[model samples]
Target chain A: MQPKSVAVVGAAETTRLGKIPDVSVIGLHADAALNAMKDAGLKPSDIDGVATAGISPVELAHYLGITPTYADGTSVGGCSFMLHVRHAAAAINAGLCKTVLITHGESGRSRVGAGGFGRAPSSLMGQFEMPYGVTSPPTMFTIPVLRYMKTHGVTEEDLATVAVIQREWAARNPRASFKDPITVDDVLNSPMIAWPFRMLMCCLVTDGGGALILTSAERAKDFPQKPVYILGTGESVETPMVSQMEDFNSSKAFRVSGKKAFDEAGIQHADVDHLMIYDAFAHLPLYGLEDLGFVKPGEAKDFIRERNTAIGGKLPMNTNGGGLSYMHSGMYGMYALQESVRQMRGTAAAQVEGAKISVSHGVGGMFAASGTVIFTNEK
Target chain B: MARLLPEPTPETRHFWEGCRDGELRLQRCTDCTHSYFPPRAFCPKCGSRDVEIYAASGKATLYSYVINHRPRPDMGTEPHSIAVVELAEGPRMMTNIVGCPQTPEALILDMPVQVRFDKQTDDISLPLFEPAKG
Candidate 1:
């Protein structure tokens, strides 16, 4: 049986990207949620469900004056929203709830107040990973990236295509952190932040918020906005600890998640008109392109170097500038969904012509959890 | 300068005791004799509670490694070699390779290595590994 259609009715975000000292994290979330509702012509009472990541769901619901019938506070890292997208869709399909609001906000770059949302203490994950002094998200990702380069002979310049190409897109995106163009030489010359990696290769940390509203297809038509359909989604866990993974060079999580999502959607890589592979680091997209079947393993570098991922390339990726240029916002996955929705609605400033199909893949917990969602204008 | 940093929990106590007593310990299934690391009480091979801890020859080869140059709070200024070693006893162990420079030229893949100890404090002597002396 085919899946029921879950349409994204509204999407909106805060004005600032890197650092917004004027607004609190909750304030940012509330603003984005209200804007999304306004854009979708939804009232607070219209939202019967709420899902949040890296922030408190109950708190966000409270601020929005929404006593949601359903709420989720899943913390699987950046990809939590991608997982939430699938969960929210299933819930609406099952008639569990309608008009779900998914939101994310963070003051990561500003390091606002040194605390906002804290996970459960009993989690051994922080202990195993943090004490090794692997505090930053990109640091953990670099481990596998380094191993990938070592095994594949992929160079730093090869991985630089992710940042360089995304930066080019950011040049056109007014909200991007970096408006200036950067070249492979600039990436190679950048200071070494991590061995086998340079400063240009890592993603930026910034403060921002993004919110999207999902409703049943039947209800979406009743709303005032165009419906961007959720084509297919898949979520899974490969390994919680970076060390436990058998293959550091390749993300088994991405391989498994992408295969399942593509198969469920009944779509091949060629069918995707655009892509939003998460760029927590430049290597992410490089490896993601390889794992998502866009290119052969160990060939992402050459593909990217050949400019296959540029603005005018075969796949116009991260059209809203991605984490490198757009807003990291703690978890960048939510923005992936936002961008896909915008593109399908033909509302994106950098909208790709005839963009009917797009893929947004999110990874969290040092390649531990992965979720992939395919969005299409056609149901 | 070598001492027991922190012994393994009940889940890995035998592995710790083996290192302390000069033996490379592995969790083995009494039924299949398969060994594993980051030890577990139950045998993964047969899903059996019938398992025993045995001493290995403390030998392994470099399965993979990365020289981490990023500044870390706990590790301080020195670059460290993070290696995943494929043990002769069958399981892979995540450990640091020390007593030599951390570089691709210095650390080669498939190079024979043996376990060593770095005494961090009274209760925590880390089990570090290094190249086996010729």
Candidate 2:
């Protein structure tokens, strides 16, 4: 059976996501949700269903002042919010809810004093890998980052080039955390966080929240703002154990999710006008670009150095400054979708030219989980 | 740092005991002659319940590795080599390479290595692998 067509009628985000001193976690989520309703020109009464994630969800429902017909708080690494979008579409399409709000918030910067895990990792983590000293997400991701470098002969400078490109794009974005331009030399000289991964390559911890509202395409016409249709969405997961992974060089989940998304949307990579890939680390985009089939294997380094990822290149990627320069909330996938919606409506602060067709991707858990969504102006 | 600790179960008791003794023993299915680690009762290869706990040669070849330069507060120092070693007895193990600095030139893929144990305390000794020159 064909699913009902869903449209993204609202997109709202908090201020630049470094550390917010006074705001509580629920407060941050409430602010984003309230702003989204205003952006859609809809009231809180318009939201009958909700999908939330990242540390706190039920608490947010109580603060929002409405009981949802459907509520979900499934946290699957960092891509949980993007997955929520998929689940929300089904809820809205099935008439389980007239309107759905998806939200996420994290006080990572303040709770952990920035650069801390904030809370204990999952219990399974402590039982399996923690005793050996495999602690924190950066340390986990560094395994593959190092493997990719060794397998491809990719240099630390190659990793630094991604930071440079993203920083160049971030310089133009008003909401970007780091607006100051950084050179490749600056990245190379930065302190090493992990072997082969420097401080520059890692993402900055930020406290923030993002929100998106969805309704059936038929209901979108009544809203004041232009609606961005959810053309197609897909998700995939791989082995959570980094050691048991089939391959360390690239993420299989990206390929699986991207294929399903493109197939459902009836579009190809060549047809995409813009791409918003989640960038928790600099190597993230490099692997994502390759796994998404935008470039050949072991060629993303050359792809970035050739300036194909920048503005006016073959692909305009992470125009919102990306997590590298943008905000690295606990889960960055929501921001990617938010930016795509803004770009499609010609409302982005740093809009990509003629962005009618866009692709937003979210990667989570050390190359273990990935989700992809294709959005187009037309339903 | 907390996630790396091994939690020993009934099937894994013997293997962990071997590590304490500075010996690397693998679970072998006597019926099919299959070997495995992170010890288990049923053979992952042949699903045989009948198995033997025997000492392995402790020799292996480097399958893959990464040198972590960013060590967290609990984990002191950076640039440690975490590796996947293919055992000569036909099973794979996840371990670290010690007694040498972790560098691209030092931690090459397919390099021969041998197991060594670091006694953390009286009852606990961790297994670490290092390059073994013939």
Candidate 3:
């Protein structure tokens, strides 16, 4: 269904973005949720719908003392929040609920109240993948990247440039974890985590959370904040195992979800004033750019090398520093959504001037799943 | 300490058992003739319950790989190659490329390889791949 009149009324990250050892996982969720409610000037009783991932919606409801008429616990990993926003809009339009609150919180650094994730020894990954020492994301995610480099003729300097340019954006954001500029040599010289991926290329492990409040555009004006109208949203999933992706060079899920969103929004790549592609790793933006049709396949390396995605470029991307240099609390999608809202609201720390349209895209697992959301301040 | 090993379930007992007996076993759909790995009860391709087990040719090609350098407590400090090999029977499985150095120069993409089993536990023998010698 097309999102006709749904708008984000409230959006805020946790009071403290990085390294909050004092708050547990649920506390981070509650903090972000409460802040969003206050931002929208709403109480727990004012919310009738709730959607979340990582932490269950049931637990969030109990923690916030909310009794929602509708609840969604769609946990597809990092991109789950973008999917939540899409689902929330559909639910509001269906008259299932009036106001929906979506939240995300992960104590990735502290692992406080964080759930353990691993396949059983008898599961598909255990039998087919894990026995080969493919245990963590750093290892599993590298499964496709090497082949992508080979097929695209992407050089190591091109990959390192992703980290370098993002660091340039990060240097402007005061809240960014790594504000110091890093050179391409710095990234390539950083200790290698997995082959072709150095520590600099990976996302930062921090404790943080974010929340959003959505309602029909008719009621959106009642809130204090400017409404960021939802133009389109799409979500899709591929194989759970990274190795089983349809092709190593591209993501089928990314293509499907992005096309659906762009089609629903009736917008072209040129219309996007600001963009946020969940940069959990440096290579993710390259995949997002190509798969979302913003750039041609095998050309993202050149796009970044030319600084098209950097500050003062044609397209401003990941203005909040992204997961690579910002804050990656396990699931980085919520943070991506928060940045898109900030850009649309024109209140971002590293605000893109007069940004009218913004797109937030995310990936879950390796290339296992994807969600794309398009927002416009005009409406 | 060593890396994690797979524990066979009732549905996958045959595949592991075959490895113990020096054979690479795979499941094939009786209806669609589609062969698959990691032994599932139903055929993933045709969604048919009519499936049978058969020994594979033990030949494959290196599809992709990464030389991991992180030192896990269970995996020790030495670097190892985590690879995916596309089997001659038309399925890819994640395994390690052994009998060669774990370096980018040594592990060429699309190089032909053959499976070799290493006994992890008494009841389990993990399948690993080695560079195919002509």
Scored by lDDT, the top model is 3
Which numbered prediction scores highest in DockQ against the true structure?
3
What's the lDDT for residue A29 in model 3? 96
Model 1, CA-based lDDT: 0.78
My TM-score estimates for the predictions, one after another, are: 0.92, 0.90, 0.97
For model 1, state the Cα shift of residue A112 in Å: 2.2
Collision count of model 3: 0
Residue A124, model 3: lDDT of: 75
Better of 1 and 2 by TM-score: 1
Supply the TM-score for candidate 3. 0.97
TM-score of chain A of each: 0.94, 0.94, 0.99
Q: Lowest summed lDDT over 10 consecutive residues: which window, candidate 3 chain A?
A: A127-136
Q: What is candidate 1's CAPRI-style docking category based on DockQ?
A: acceptable
Put the candidates in DockQ order, highest first: 3, 2, 1
Residue-level lDDT of model 3, residues A1-379, one tens digit each, is 5654899999989999888888999999999999999999999999999999987899999889999999999999899998999999999999999999999999999888887868897787877788888767889877888889889998778888988998888998898989999999999999988888899988999999999999999999888999999999999999888777768889999999999999999999999999999988888899899999999999999998898999998989999889999999989999999999999999998899989999999999888899999999999
In model 2 chain B, the worst 10-residue window by lDDT is B1-10
lDDT of 2 by residue, A273-359 (tens): 889888988888988899888888899999999998897787889988898888887678888888899889998887887788989
Worst 10 residues of 1 chain B by lDDT: B1-10
Stretches of candidate 3 exceeding 4 Å from the true structure: none
- Sorted into a CAPRI-style docking class, model 2 comes out as acceptable
Q: Looking at model 3 chain B, which ten-residue stretch has the lowest summed lDDT?
A: B70-79
